[model samples]
Target: MKTLLIWCLPALAWAQAPAANPPGPWSGGLGVGNGLEAHATRQTGGHLLLLGRARYAWWGPKSGPGSKLFDQLNTRSRQTELAVLAGRSLPVGRCRAYAAAGLAYLLGRQLGDYRYTTRSSGLLWGDATYYYAYRRYQALGLPLEIGFQGPLGRNQQRLGLALQANFNPERSAYCVLLTLNLSSWGNRIK
Candidate 1:
């Protein structure tokens, strides 16, 4: 019985051992559905990272027909945010899932054009003219994100798919992004 128990222990240990290390810093991919997402992260420690990203979308409401109106009115209907994130990875099977929260700067604008009438009839129609105004609002936002990351190439590069939610005083927006970690650029750091 002792011999059988010892043999089983080695098998159990092998089964419970951690998976191999994921490819390093640079990793990203392309696909169809929403859009593309890319990111770069600098590791500060074993479980900490500083991240930044630039994203673009071509099918969203903010980028469609209404965009022309916003351009004409000198208002911005799109979004560009800069953020810093920190999170830790929890191993799940062969992959790692992470949850991160951070702060971001939200920048965008809105425009409207309307006419006001003093009377309901055509008599006052001449008195009303085109009224145009541009509104611009900028605020700091809180961003919360969760996603999974894993190895893609033979090197240290990794690919990540994540969902990011931005909370602002006025409104909130959600984005799905695919990120690539540029491990090559990261290795230059001493």
Candidate 2:
């Protein structure tokens, strides 16, 4: 019985041990593929995160038939998003797979180009001006993200890839992002 017990002890000890590398609590990501999403996230407890995000995208000018060559259609946008999220991480092979969902507040600002035509001293002058045409609105959104991460240099920092979707009554956007995660369980989760 002593010999059998000694053999089982090693296996039980390994089972009780944590993995060599674990996902951290702090994650910052910059997404750029078709569009851009810049976000920072910090874990509050074991499975909850608080996030602040900002995004900017250039949609380009709008064109149509019956429009002159000089006719301008300017559209651009900037946005800010805040969220409180909950998530769980599962061990997959040597890495961790995570999924999170949250409620978000989005502030969107739409920019447009203004065209001004001026006549000075009976001389006709055509001028085009590029300025911020402000159209700001706020909406509530649902944000979802799924991804996998692995430790880079110890369990303090990790590198991961994620796919995200942000949806609201006004618009819906998605992103494929690369993330750098730093563990915040010890110091500040900022």
Candidate 3:
């Protein structure tokens, strides 16, 4: 009985140790929508994401602007973006959330031609030329999210969703994202 008690005490101590919770290494997804801006112009674009992305964040924000004309000239611009994310485990009822903020760069372009009159000659000129330009802006914002993860078929996988709100010196945008995760790939020893 004394020998059995000594063996069981070590096992109980190992089981009572708190599990470690660390940030995930890599995650990516594909999504298509036009809720980033509040303009009539619909934007179609995809982003490639890298997790633990704190090193290269010094590049700031990415932005662009443009003008379109159909009898009347219309101009538009975008200034900021936010990324909110989370992870969870249902068996343990555990969850975590994180937010990131940065700057955005803006690009501008003209899509149509408009007539201009020469101030000195008083002569009307009908010439069409496209214009392109870029501008840089700063932004600081955050996003919040929740998620869950567990074991599946000898492999560990996680699923999560997030809503992000980004704000910059000029404007703000919102994004909704769905994430899928597969982990424990390289830790197996056969």
What is candidate 1's lDDT per residue for 1-190, written digit by digit as tens? Answer: 9999999987655444543453344333332224345556654334646476544423223443234433333223345566777777677655567788888887655444433323234754632222334446688888787877664333444556788777888446678876644454444343
Tens digit of lDDT per residue, candidate 2, span 68-118?
Answer: 434433434555666666676776765677788888888776555544433
- Say what the RMSD of model 3 is: 18.3
The candidate with the higher lDDT, 1 or 3, is 1
For model 3, state the Cα shift of residue 26 in Å.
Answer: 6.5
Output the lDDT of residue 161, model 1: 74
- Against the reference, the lDDT scores of all candidates come to 0.55, 0.61, 0.33
Deviating ranges (above 4 Å) for candidate 1: 1-38, 44-46, 56-76, 111-134, 186-190
> Poorest 10 consecutive residues of model 3 by lDDT?
38-47
Pairs that clash in candidate 2: none
Report the C-alpha lDDT of model 3 over 41-69, residue by residue, as the tens digit.
11112221222211111121222222332
Task: Give per-candidate clash totals.
Answer: 13, 0, 15
Once fitted onto the true fold, the runs of candidate 2 whose alpha carbons sit more than 4 angstroms away are 1-58, 61-75, 111-134, 184-190
In terms of lDDT, the best-performing candidate is 2
